[model samples]
Target chain A: MSETPASSVPRRVRDASEAEILDRLLPRYAAARGAEVGPGDDAAVMIQLGDRYVVTTDMMIHGPDFRWAWHTPFELGWKAAVTNLADVYAMGARPTGLVIALAATADTELTALEELADGLTAACARLAPGCAVVGGDLSVSDTFTIAITAFGDLEDRAPVLRSGARVGDVIALAGDAGRAAHGLDLLFAEGVDAAGVPNADATAALRAREPELVAAQLTPNPPIPAGIDAALAGATSMMDVSDGLALDASRIARASSVALDLDTAAFAAEPNLERALRGGEDHALLATFPATSTLPEPFRAIGVVRAGAGVLRDGAPLTGKLGWDPYTAWDGQLG
Target chain B: MSETPASSVPRRVRDASEAEILDRLLPRYAAARGAEVGPGDDAAVMIQLGDRYVVTTDMMIHGPDFRWAWHTPFELGWKAAVTNLADVYAMGARPTGLVIALAATADTELTALEELADGLTAACARLAPGCAVVGGDLSVSDTFTIAITAFGDLEDRAPVLRSGARVGDVIALAGDAGRAAHGLDLLFAEGVDAAGVPNADATAALRAREPELVAAQLTPNPPIPAGIDAALAGATSMMDVSDGLALDASRIARASSVALDLDTAAFAAEPNLERALRGGEDHALLATFPATSTLPEPFRAIGVVRAGAGVLRDGAPLTGKLGWDPYTAWDGQLG
Candidate 1:
């Protein structure tokens, strides 16, 4: 946690040399488990477990991706790592190493960067043990940005692809679904001032009102272990539920050329079924298995694959808004 | 190459959906050689050739890293790939895959993105055959940013680290040195208008006047293949010469806990020895080999390792302005 600064302000990035910044920050990020050569080299070398590996990349920008007033730097770093790690886990692989490129304005405080590094290491320690930042780059930019690439080891198991679903396969879900979306809606409606600017006091009040929802939106804890469990339990197909359950399920349906029929009664216990169907950024694991196979722990049956296309709810066409698309949805508005 | 517009501007990124943009751009980036699942899945699965792998990352932002008037989209993409590939090659490894995260404004033209993709694949084809873009992410930002993470196959060879150099080793150079710095000087002195804005006509005229220098600055072709050769020929220590020769050589000396003595006569044929000694951004290969071993064809001996600390020119301590540090060097100006 950072101390509340006085009027003079704390030391900024521009005040320190690049080498000084690295000397202060690199030690905070834990080294990767199997890295033959870690940071301070031209490249980091990692020991491989099998003959195949999985890699995924994701980016989070200051404007469209997040608001500084609503989330701390630690949360941003944690979410950035979690997003890419979820992608690797979707393939039933254990994450091994990560390479991050962080771009920030010179006026930004060094404490913010230090907290961000702390958050990255904390997430890896809690979610996927043995995975850590192995190498990274830092640069000055007009906009603050965090770009991460995660690598994983398969250990000889075949990758679980979204196109492998078969007719009569049972669809299963792991982790929270609609909570993050509900939290975002709450933040927009009540956590901002009259001018749509995020207010610290207002955000704190909103978090107090809905702790679980706010936490889910700020720091999601996806079922990372369940991905490998589902794979080992004979999953036919798998994906990360990033762009809402319906949209991501539709992707699996289209990729496999099959229809997914969800039972509305199955999710009746969810606080908000609509948000669960149409919200985004939960990063939960969505997987399909043979009808005869038992569902993996933490994974519950939600739908079944049929001989058709598109997504269905209770044997009818599912419609309305699906998910977030950064290209078309962003309206040039900052936090 | 993009055609010069007559009057009306081309379609901007905001006009098309995310899916539409991906459909137009993904095909231009060729598939990675060993990718079992490329681009479409949550993560890409790459077949490993050995029990070890190399990874590195680098970032290029529009304001601090490049100017649109001086660099075309193709050149930006090519240089981005080349920079990271050089780091992998510095470890004596063969690059195999890259995952890029690109963030640009909504008003950016689609042709620019297309050309960037073309340049990425073209660089792979020319510099490191069989390596290609395998996965990536896109986002909207106020500043254009390209963050790339490159992966390489070690294939049973030991990685050449900068800390392995010993006394009596012969230091060698394998690529251009100071030419890019001279090209940068030309751009700043003659390729800009009165207001310090980069002028297209002036840049073209400068390129026409000095083809190789301008090319080295904008589109450098580093000695990627020579890295593997040096390793095969028993390189003791290696590094990618991103900073000036003197500054980067100091890094090797410090890491190895020894001194390096450069012979000024070795580079007597250079057009500008000062730039060669103090300019950066060449992405050349600098390595050390045993005194008894024969130097590789592309590698020419330039100096020798001595039992001391720091770098020296003709047995004297080397001193002057060395290289660049983005955190302190950028002045918040754009072309």
Candidate 2:
């Protein structure tokens, strides 16, 4: 929280050498069950249960993907890991292990880094049991950055790709949405700073007022279980709503060469429909299934696939920007 | 050369959108043979050739791992790829695929990124025939950094680890050494700058003065083939001379719990023993074999595994540091 320091106790990284940092941190990250040989070796040998592995990597840097004022080091590590794990789950694979690269300036505190390791390991245990942080690299850089590459095993289930959706299919959504965008709004309105946020108990006060919203921005909980459930229920196409529902739905449409038409009336009763439909980083699973198939729980039908491209609302083509595009969107500028 | 600029024509990344950058550069990097499904998806699906897979990652930040004045973007990409590949090879596995995470400031030219992608593809084509750049994430950062995760297939062969060495074994090394360290010296002596080197083209003029040394630093050609050779020839223990020979050798000694007594006279005939002995980033494979076995080409016996621990020069304990220890070595301070 902005009211608290990145670490409960301050300890600069320069106070200890790289060796001491590794020694203090490596033990904090638990080993994965799938790793035949774990960290400390030249390379990690992770056992395979299938013929192919699903791999994805995501990077979080101080200036672009996130701002230090909005999140703690532990939150940074947790959020970064979850983003990649969501991608792996979106492919319908069971998460296996992750390799992390942390680069920070000499001024960074060792306690902050250790907290980051704790968050990473803790997140892995909660979201993807049996999966662990297998290996990592530490380096000094002018800006703080975290790069995580997560892998998963398919386990006989065919990967559900973005290109597999078909016309005449039922489009469905799982997991919550829009809270992160609202959380970002709260952060913007508060104008937090490095000097620290007033004397308010940031996390506790935010929790009492907008706990879910703030948490959505700080700690995104990806629908890890729902992805596999959708795959098992014969979902033809799937992708996580990392970049917002409208944009991600459009992605599925473009990839599958079909059209997705959403009904605004279906969500009119809900508050903040625009944010629900267009807010990014919800980490929800958007999927399509055969119209006749019984849909899975938490996955409610919101649209129908049609013989066209792009996304439509109220039977009309949506105009203007629908969601975040790092290059084109204003939110993409400096995170 | 710095005079030519990072791009033949200026094209700042900030001038274009993220989509435009990907459109301009993704095609430059080739796909690998192992990918069942490649980039542009929720996750990459790569087929495994064996029961287990070799995975390792390394990061290079501009200020620490390299200097902008000394190496071009292409060279940075190449050197970074080789460094990661060396870890895979050290595990006695054939390189398969790589995932890269690149972060740079918005002011960087798109052409520079393209050159980096080209270098990644070129390095793959050269050192790893079947390997390819699978997927990646691009972000904005104040300092330029590249995080590469490379994986490999070991087939049915047993992995040669750093803890397998035993007493009465012949210690050997394959690949060139010390040139990179001296190359660092050349860069330091030349004092290259942001405005570009005066009169002399950095790469060309430096090559004319010390081609091997300069090349060693800018574009190190790691001994990719010798790793498998050592494994096939029954290497008891193995690792690459990445940090430095003395430092890495001591690592094997510590891991295997055996002393390595080196004969400096064996390398005395070689020019510049300091570079060969203490210089790092050589990417050369070092291994220990049974004393009775014949050594392979490019691999020469230079020491003996003994009852004690740590590295020794001749009969007595060697004083002063021989190679880099990231934690204890001064080189680890900023970098």
Best by lDDT: 1
Per-residue CA lDDT of candidate 1, range B12-104, in tens?
676777777788889998878878889988999999998899999999898788888888999999999999999999999999999999997
TM-score of chain A of each: 0.95, 0.90
Give interface RMSD for all predictions. Answer: 0.8, 1.5
Provide the lDDT at B223 for model 2: 70
The DockQ-derived docking category for candidate 2 is medium
On residues A1-335, what C-alpha lDDT tens digit does candidate 2 reach at each position? 12334554436665566667888888998879999888888898889988888889899887667776667788888898889889998999999999998887767878789889988987888889889888888887778889999999988789999998888899998877677777876766553534444223454455568777888888988666688889899999999888888989998999999988887776665579998889888888999999997888788888888989999986788766778865545343343
lDDT of 2 by residue, B234-334 (tens): 99998888888887888899999988888888787767887778889889888999988788778988899998989888856766777764434434323
Query: Best-fitting candidate, measured by TM-score?
Result: 1
Worst 10-residue lDDT window, candidate 1 chain A: A1-10
Q: What is the lDDT for A80 in model 2?
A: 87
- Residue A139 lDDT in candidate 1: 89
Off by over 4 Å in 1: A1-10, B1-10
**Every model's Cα RMSD, please?**
3.0, 4.1
